[model samples]
Target: MAFSPLVDQLLDALRVLPGVGPKTAQRMAMHLLERDRDGGRQLARVLMQAAEDVGYCQRCRTLTEQPLCELCESPRREDRLLCIVESPGDMLAIEEAGGFRGRYFVLHGHLSPLDGIGPDDLGLDALDAVMEQAGVDEVILATNPTVEGEATAHYLAQQLKPRGVTLSRLAYGVPMGGELEYVDGGTLSRAFMGRQPFND
Candidate 1:
C-alpha cells in the first residue's frame, strides 16, 4: 500500500527543496517519523517562523528578518564598492570565498520575459535610485554566466554606464585546481577567451 495522506503530504513538501527527489523525500519523511519526530517538529517550527518573518533587506534586497541585513548595517564594509549578485546564496558564496570586502546588492532573480520577470521585478528601479546617490564608485556584476544573466548584466551596463560609475563583470573559466584534460570544452573555451597576460 502507499503512504497515508499526511505522510504523502510530508514527502511532497520535502520534495520542494532543490535536488530532493521522491525517493529522497520519502527517506526524509521516514527518518523524521520513525527516528526523530522531535527534531522534525523543531524544524517545522523554525521553518514556519523563518518563512513568516524573513524579508528582503531594505538596502541590499537579501533575505533578512530585520529592516537591514548585517552586511548593510555593518560600518566595516566598503561603501564605494558594491557587488551585484543574482541571489542571497550567491552573495554568501562570495563572502565565504573571502578577500572581497565590498558591499552587495542582491537581485532575487535574473530578467526572464517568458516567465514574466522584468527589470522592475529584479529591483532595477531601486538599484538606479541607489546608484543615483553618491558614494558607490563601482559596481561588480556577479550574476551567473547564463543567457538571462548576460542579458541582465548588459541591461544594467546600459542603465548604469550613463551614470559614470565603473562597471565590471565576474570572469568565468575552468576551476583553479582542475586539470585541463578533464575540463569541459565550453569551460576551456571560456578560459582561453578570458586569458590574462602574465606579468614578468
Candidate 2:
C-alpha cells in the first residue's frame, strides 16, 4: 500500500535535497516518524529559521545572518589579498584548511553558458567593485577544476588584469602523497604546466 498524503508529501519534500533518492527520502521519513520525532521537529525549526534569517554577506557574499560575514567584518584578515571561490562551501573548505589569511569573494556559482549562468549571475560586478574599493593587490581564483570553472577563471583574469591587479589561479597539481600513476591526464598536464623548481 502507498503512504498517506502527508507521508508522501514529506517524502517528496525530503527528496528535494541534493543526492537524495526516493528510497532514501522514504527511509528518512520513516526514521523521523518512528524513532526521532523530536529530532525531526528540531531540524524543521532550525531549517525554517536558517532559511528565513540567512543572507549573503554584503561585502563577500558568503552566507550569514548579518550585513557582512564574520570574515569580512574581521580586522585581522588581510585586505590586500582576495580569494574568489565558487560557493560558501568552498570558502568553508579553505577556512578549515587554515592556510589562507586573506579576505574572500564568493561567486556562488560558475559561468555555465549551457545552463544560462553568466558573470552577472555570479556577481562579478560586485567583485570588481569590492576590488576597486578595497585596493586588492592580488586575487586568487579558487574555482573548481572543471571546464566551466576554467572558463570562468579565464574570464575573470581578462577582466581583472586591465585593472593592474595581480590575478592568479590556484595551482593545479598532484595531491601531497598521491601516486602520480593514479593521477588523471588533465591534472598531470596542469601540474606540468604549473611546475616549479625544487625548494630543497
Candidate 3:
C-alpha cells in the first residue's frame, strides 16, 4: 500500500536525523499523524527556530542562539585553560561532568584525510586566533580516542606548540575509539582530572 505523499514526506524528512531509519521515521510519522498533532507542531516550531536562530559561537564553535555562547561570555571561566573537543556534544558531556572549570574550543569534527577534512576545514585559523587573542596558557586535546581523533590532536598540538601553549590529552579512561559524548559524566570528569601531557 502506498502511503500518502504527506506521510511519505514527513517520514523522509525525519529520516535525516542520525540513527533514524525508514522504519523509525515511518513509525514517528504515523504516531505524529495519529495522536500527537500538537506535539508535532511544537517540535516543528522548535526545529525551525533552532535552524534559523542557532549558530556556532564565534570563539568556541559551539552551537548557540547568540554570537558568543554562555561559556565564552562567562567571566568565571578560566581564560588561560582551553579544552579542545571534537564537537558541541562532547562539550556538553564535559559540562555535565561539572569538573572542568576552564573554557573550551570545539573543533566541530576531527581530521579525516580519507573523508577530505583538513586543518582548514576544522577551523584551525579560528583556533589560532583564539589562542593568540585569549592568551591561552594550556590546551587540553580532548578529542576522541579514535585514530582520526588522535591524528587531529597531534596535528593541533604540533601547530600550537610554537605558540608556547602547554598541550595535554585526556587520560585513557575513555575507551579506545570511543567518542567523548558517549562517555559517562564520572568517567569524563576523571579523564579530565587525570589528563596527561601530549608529548610529540
The candidate scoring highest on TM-score is 2
RMSD of each: 1.7, 1.2, 6.6
Number of the top lDDT candidate: 2
| Tens-digit lDDT track of model 1 for 18-130 | 99999999999999999999999999999999999999998899999999999989989888898999999999999999988889999999999999998889888778766
> What global local distance difference test value does model 2 have?
0.93
Tens-place lDDT per residue, model 3, 1-200, is 76988887888899899999999998898899899999999999999999999999999999999999999999999999999999999999999989999999998899998889888888888898898898789999999988899899999989989888889997666777989899998778878877878999
Q: Number of clashing pairs, model 2?
A: 0
lDDT, candidate 2, at 177: 97
Clashing residue pairs found in predicted model 3: none
Q: Model 1, which residues run further than 4 Å from truth?
A: none
Can you write out model 2's per-residue Cα lDDT over 53-156, one digit (the tens) per residue?
99999899999999999899999999999999999999999999998999999999999988999789998878978988998999999999899898999999
TM-score of each: 0.92, 0.95, 0.85
Q: What value of lDDT does candidate 1 attain over all alpha carbons? A: 0.91
Determine which window of 10 residues in candidate 2 has minimal summed lDDT.
Answer: 123-132
Clashing pairs in 2: none
